[model samples]
Target chain A: MKKILSLGLLCTTILLSQAQAASTPTVSGVFEKTVHAFAENHAPLGQIPASDLLNQPVAGIDEETGFLKVQTPKGLVLVARAAVTTTMTAAAPRETSCSYIGTLAASGTGSSSGFASNCKAGAR
Target chain B: MMVMFWIVYKFFDPLSLESATKNSSAQFFSAITAPFYGLSSPRSHQRVAVVTINDPTLQQFDAALPLSYQRQVFILRQILEADPAAVFVDFRMAYEHTDESLSLFQSVLDEAKSKHIPIFFARGEEGQDQIHLLPPLRNVESYSNALETSSAYPLLFEEGNAALKEDEPSQEETRKPEANAAFDVYRSLCTSTWSGQCGSFHEDDFRRPMMIQWGLHVDPAQTQVSSLANSPRNICAVPFSGGFFCRSIVQSFTLGFRAFWGSSRDYEVGHAYYPLTIGAHQLGERGLGTPAGSPPLSHLLKGRAVFYGTDIRDQHDDTVLPFLGRVPNVVLHAMAFDNLVTYGNHYFHEPSEVEFGHGVHIGQAEICEFILWLIFTGWMAFKFYYSHPEVPRGHGAKLRHDIRRKSRDFLSLSLSVNALVPAIFCAALAAFDLSHQPTLLNGMDEALLYVCLFLVLLGTLVLLRRSAQRSQPEEAEHAHGPEESEAEKAEKFRLGFWAHLALLTSLTAIVFALNELFIQWPNADWIGFILLWLAVGESCESTGFVLTFVNFLNRRSHALTSERVPNSESSSQ
Candidate 1:
C-alpha cells in the first residue's frame, strides 16, 4: 500500500512539473519575437505576443523614440526596445511510437515477424 | 618494486600527457568546485568588458576583410568617447588603405593617445603574414595575436619568437619583450584598479603564463527554460539550475570524491562565466555617448578594459577556453586580462622545475609525487611484512588464526574501517595542501578547505571510537589460538613472501600508470590520492587489521568450489 501511494505521488509530481513547464512561454531571437515587458522592479508589466507582429516577423523601429512598432489587440503599440528581451528556451524532443520503432529496427534484431506484428497493431 | 615504480613515473612521457592531463583536470576542478564560486555570488568580472563586432554589427557596417579603415576609425572613436581604461583591437588590418582612409584611422589613434586611453592593435603571426598596420596608423601600441593551445594564456612573448622578429623596430617597442594585448592592458590599468598589491614593474615578479581561474556567474533571469534555449552559452552547465541553492544542495552529494575527476567539453564551459559583453553596434548607438546623467555605456565602459573584436559566427579567429568553450580571440584576451587584474599575478602556474643544489632539476609536482609514492610503499612494506607476527600470538590472535584456517575469514568489518579511515584522512590532508596559501584562498579553495577539514574531523572521531572499542580485553588467552602447527606456520610464511610481493608490486604499478596517464587531468590528483589511500588500506588489511571483505570473497569462492564437486573421488580426479 505504501509503495502504491509513493508511486502515485511520483506520477502526480511529474505531471505537475510538466504542467508548470508548459505554462511558461519561450521566445527566441532579438527581433520580431514575442516579448513580455517587466516593470522597474522586474514585475510583469505586459506581453507583446508574436500575433501582434502579424504572426510572422517585423523589424519596424521608431527611429526617434527607439521603440519597436507592433500591432496589439486594441491598437498600434510601441514597446521600448531595451525593455524587451529574447528568452531562448530549449526545445524538448517529442518521442513517439514511430521513433521508438525506428530505434528498435536500428538495433539490427533482423526479426521481420515482430516488426510486421508491431506495424499491424498501428504501433508506428 | 618501489625503485622501478619511481623510475617509470619519472621518465614516463609516452604521450604529451602533462598538458592534456592538467587541462582536463583543471576543467573538472573548475566544474565540481563551481558552487563555491557562487559563495562570492557575483562572479561576472567587472574590470573587463567585451565590445564585440558581432554578426549584426558586421551586417550593419557591411564590413568584410580587409576591413575598411573608416569602420575601424568609427569603432575607436566610439570606444574612446565612453572613456575606456584600455582598448584591445583584435582585428588585423591586412590590406593597404588609401591615403585619406589611413589619415582618418590615424586621427583616431591620435585622439586615443591624447586622452591617455591606450589602444592596442592586433599584430599578426604565422599564417597571416601580410597583417601590418599602415605607418601613419601605427601611432599606438601593437600586441601579438598568437593563441596558445592551453586555457592558460602566456603574457610575455619574446620578440624573436613570432611575427615581431622580422618587423622593423617601431616607437611602441619597449625594453621589455612584446607582451600580449591582455597583459599590456592589465599593466596599464592594474595600478589604479588594484592599488599597491599589483606591485612594481620588475620583470622577475610576473609568472609568464597563468591559468585563468574561471568565475561562475549565475544571472537569475537566465534560469528560465526559454532563456536557456536561446542563450545556453552563459549558464553553468550543471544538472540543476536553481542557481546557488541548487549548487549547495548538489555539492553535499559529491563530497570530496568528485574533486579529482570531473565531467569533461561537456564540462568545458560548465563554470558558465563570460565577461560582460555589448555589441559594437550597441556601444556605437547615438544615445549611449550622451554625457547627460550617467549613460549605460559610460557606466559599462568607464575605467574598464574594453576588447573590441569581431565575433562573426563563422570567423576563424576563435580559441577554446577550458571553462568558456570556443570564444573569439578578443574574449580570450579579455578573460586573461581580467584574471590578471582580479588576482594580481596570483594565477595558476605550470608545475615549475625544482632545482636540487648540485644542478639537478626535476618537476616540482613530480618530486612531491615520488616522495609520496616512496612513503606509501614503505608503509605498505611495514604493514604487510613487519607488522604481522611470525607465530600469531596476540590479544586478537584468534582472529588471525581464523584468517589462516580459511582465507575467507580475512574479510572482517575492521579491515574496511581501517581502509576508509586512512583514505579519508589522507584526502583531507591533500585537499588542504593543494591550496597552500590559505590567505589568498578563492571561493573554490575555501570550499575544498572547508570540506576536507570537515572530513578530517569526522575521520578522527571514527578512529577514536574504533580505538576505544578495541581496547576491551575480551578473549585474552584464546587470542593466540592453538590452531596451526609449527610446520604449517613455516610453510605459510615461505609462500606469503612471494604472494605479498606480487600483490604490492602489481598495485603500485597500476597506481603509478594511472597517475602518469592523468597527472594534469582534473581530479587526477584526487583520484591518485584516493588510490594510494586504498593501497595503504589494503596493505593494512594484509597485516591482519580486520579483513572481513577479503575473507568473505575467499569463503564464498571456497563454498562454490566445494559445491561444484558432488563426490570427493570425482573432485580429486
Candidate 2:
C-alpha cells in the first residue's frame, strides 16, 4: 500500500512537470519553418508568436496599456496586444488550439504580417 | 635572529604573497634560461603552431555570430587533410546540443578517427558541477584509437596542507568522489591515447594534476630510450605497495600531444611553428574562385600540431603570467608544451633532495648551507661592530681627529655592506638558474634581515661604548682635582637613556614606513630597500647632531650656573 501510494505520487509529479513545460503554446507548419529560417539567418523575425517571444514566465500584463509582459533571456519585453490577432476555432475542445496572426511594427512604423499556429486556448 | 628569519621565510613566502605582489621565481628562471638555451628564438626549430581565430578569420565565417560547430568541423577537416603530426584542440566543448549540427560534428570526428589522425579535445569543469564532454561530442569518445580528451585546467603549485598516507588516498579524498571520477575519466582518456592502455598513468608521476614534462632532447647524441631511462622526474610509490612500484609521469595534455607527434627533435629550440591562418571569406573564396594558383591549406598544416582558439578582445581569455605579463591563455599552453617537448628531460624537474609537504622541505644540505650563511652573517655583524667603536666623550679635539681619520673607514664599511645587495641578487639568480635551488629566503628578505642585524649590532656597540665611558673616570677632571658626584652621574645616565630611547623610536618608525611602502608598492621594492638604507644613515647623522647640540647646551648651562653660584657665595661671604 505504501509503495503504491509513493508510485502514484511520483507519477503525478512527473505529469505536473510535463504540464508546466507544455504551458507555452507551440507552433508548427509554416510559422515553425519561418522561425527556424530566421534563426539560421541570424535575422530578427517580422513578427514572433507571444509564446515564442516570451518563452519564460510572465511577470505581468497591463490590460489598459495593451502590453503583455513576459520574460526573455535578455530581459523583460512589453509586447503590444494591439498587434496580435487571434482566430478562434469553432466548437474547439476546452483546451483549444487557436491560430494567432499579427503584424510587427518595423523601424519606420510599418507593420509586417506574422502567423502562428497551435496557440493555447484562453490566451490573449 | 636566525629563528625569527626562518619563521618569516616559512610563513611569508614571496611566491605565496597576494596575487598582485607575487613574483614567480620559477617562471622568471624558465624565461631567462629559455633564451640562453635558444628555446625561445624563432630559429630554434620548434614544431608547434598556433592557429588563432582572430577577427579577420571570424569575419570570413557566418559574420552574424561566432563560428558555429559546423564551421569548426570544416576547419578541422581542412587541418586533418594536411596530414599534421597531431592536432590538439584547446577549446572546450561544454554545451549541450540536440540539433542537426551535432550529427555533422560527430561525423567529422568519426572521419578523423577513421583516418587515424590523433585529435585531442579539451575538457572543461563547470565550477564544482558535473564534468563531461559536451553532450553531442561525447560520442567521439567511442573512437578510442585516434580520439582522446584532456582537462583544460591549469595546474597550480600551491602549498600542500594535508599529510600523505601510505595506503590511503591523499588529497583526492577531500574532493567530491564524482569530481575525482570525472578526473579519472580524463586521465584514462589521456593514458589510453598515449600508451594505448588505461591504468598506465600514475598519480606519483606529477607534482600536480596535468603537470607534464615535455620530452625534450637534452643531449643530441643520446638515444631516446637512454634519455628516458636516465631522466630524474619525480616519482611516487603506488598506494599500499610499500614503495614497490612507481611510474614515470608527464602531464595529460602534453602526453596526448607527445603520444601522437612523438618526441621533439634537437635544435627545435628557438624556432616556432607559425600556423597557416585562413579567413572565412578566404575559405569561401577558395570554393568560389580558382583554387589552382593558391597553395592548398593542408600543405601548410602538414607536419605540425595545429592549435585552434579565439583571440578576440571581448572574450577575455587572457592571463597575467611571469616574464610575459598578460598573454592569451593559448600562448601559455603553447609555451609550456614547447618547454616540455624541447627541454623536458633537460631543463625541468623537481630537485631530488626536496620533499613536497605543507611547504617545500629543504634537505640536510640546504639546512647546512643556511646554517653556514647564518654564521657568516653573525661574524660579519660582530666584526663591523667592534671595528667601528663609538667616539668617547671628553675628547672633543681627539674625537674630531678620530672622526677625520675613521671617516674613510666608515665610508668603506658602508660601501662593503651595500655591495652585498647586488652580490646576493646575482647569487640568487645563479642558484635559481643553475642549480634550480631557491635560497632559504629571497634576496630582498635576506638583505632586509642583514640590514636589521647590522643596525641592532651597531646600536648595541654604541650603547656598550657609552656605558663603558660613563663608568670610566674622567681624566680631565682627575687632572684638575675634582671628582664627579653620584647625583650628577645619575642625571647624566637618565639623559643618555632618554636620548637612546628617542633614537630607537625614530628608527623603528622609519623601518615600519619602509616595510609598509615595500608591501604596497612591489614594483618599487628595491628602491624602497635603498631608500631605507639612506633613511637609516640620515637618521643616525641627525641623531648624532642632536646629541652633540644637546651636550653643547648642557655644558654652556652648567658653566653659567657654576659661575653664578660662585659669585653668590663670594658676595654672601
Chain A accuracy as TM-score for every candidate = 0.27, 0.33
Q: How do the residues B1-573 of candidate 2 rate in per-residue lDDT, one tens digit apiece?
A: 333333343346445332222233223222322222322223122344455554444432313234556556766776776665456565666564333345656766677678665565655422323244654565332111110121122232222422222444465466422211113333333454434322344444333323212222222211110111111211211111113222111122232233223231111111111112222223222211223344433354555445555544445555433232333444445444443333322323322246678877754333543564466445433332222223123455355447534643443354446455434643453344334312222233333433443554355444534543553445335445554342332233232553355445334433333332222112222222222222222221313332244334455465564453332121111
Candidate 1 lDDT tens digits, B303-354:
6788887665546776654433555677678777766665455445445577
Candidate 1 docks at the CAPRI level of: incorrect
Residue B30, model 2: Cα distance from true site in angstroms: 8.6
> Against the hidden reference, what TM-scores do the models get?
0.56, 0.39
Deviation in Å, model 2, residue B483 alpha carbon: 22
Best by lDDT: 1
Worst 10 residues of 2 chain A by lDDT: A28-37
What DockQ class does candidate 2 belong to? incorrect
